[model samples]
Target: MEDDIYHVVREPEFTALFLLGADDLVETVEDVDAELRLPDGTRWSASFMTLGAVETVMNRWRETGEYGGGVFFRCSDLVIVPKGGVPAMIEAFRAIVADGPQETLGNLG
Candidate 1:
């Protein structure tokens, strides 16, 4: 993907921009980094990873001798979504911010 490639999804209370690690085809993207900005200037960030993507990473780690031989997976700000694509990730983010806990995301500013 080109450096200028990005997807933006706006909501009533916030705007989400799918930034780094995004693919040209959003639907086929298995993992991506995004930023969520609230009306109050609060910024939050999280890496969105699908279940299959996480498993793939873990398997790769198991072969490369990383993360205790892929015994576990952890990230400071990770949002695991059931499906790929920016839309699904945005949905998950919305739910997380609406009904989930603050720990689900990392504060950017």
Candidate 2:
């Protein structure tokens, strides 16, 4: 259920995005050489590459008719679920986006 949280956070030079499916967790982190690390242990390698690769992954899964009951979203640079999944993932994304990183959770670092 927790694995339903698909996210990708990065600074200016790198991008890392992951997708959570009903039966699988597909993830991608590009620019692995730029040396930027997010709290989730994902790192951005460079400054130009984007989460576009992440989109590609999501699109692939969406095209597959097999994964039919998962939540779905295209968060900033991350894509999450399709059809249906744990509700907590949505709440988590909201909390993380609205309060955790920008103006609140000073300790999420």
Best by lDDT: 1
Query: lDDT of model 2 at residue 33?
Result: 17
Tens digits of per-residue lDDT, candidate 2, 1-109, equal: 3223544434343333334334433233331211234546543222212345445545667777424422353333232333222232333344444443333222223
Pick out the ten consecutive residues of candidate 1 with the lowest summed lDDT.
19-28
Which lDDT tens digits does candidate 1 get at residues 37-81?
888888888888889999999999999999999999998899888
TM-score for each prediction? 0.84, 0.22
User: Count of backbone clashes for each model?
Assistant: 0, 14
- How far off is residue 82 in model 1, in Å? 0.9
Candidate 2, residue 71: Cα displacement in angstroms equals: 9.7
| lDDT score, candidate 1 | 0.81
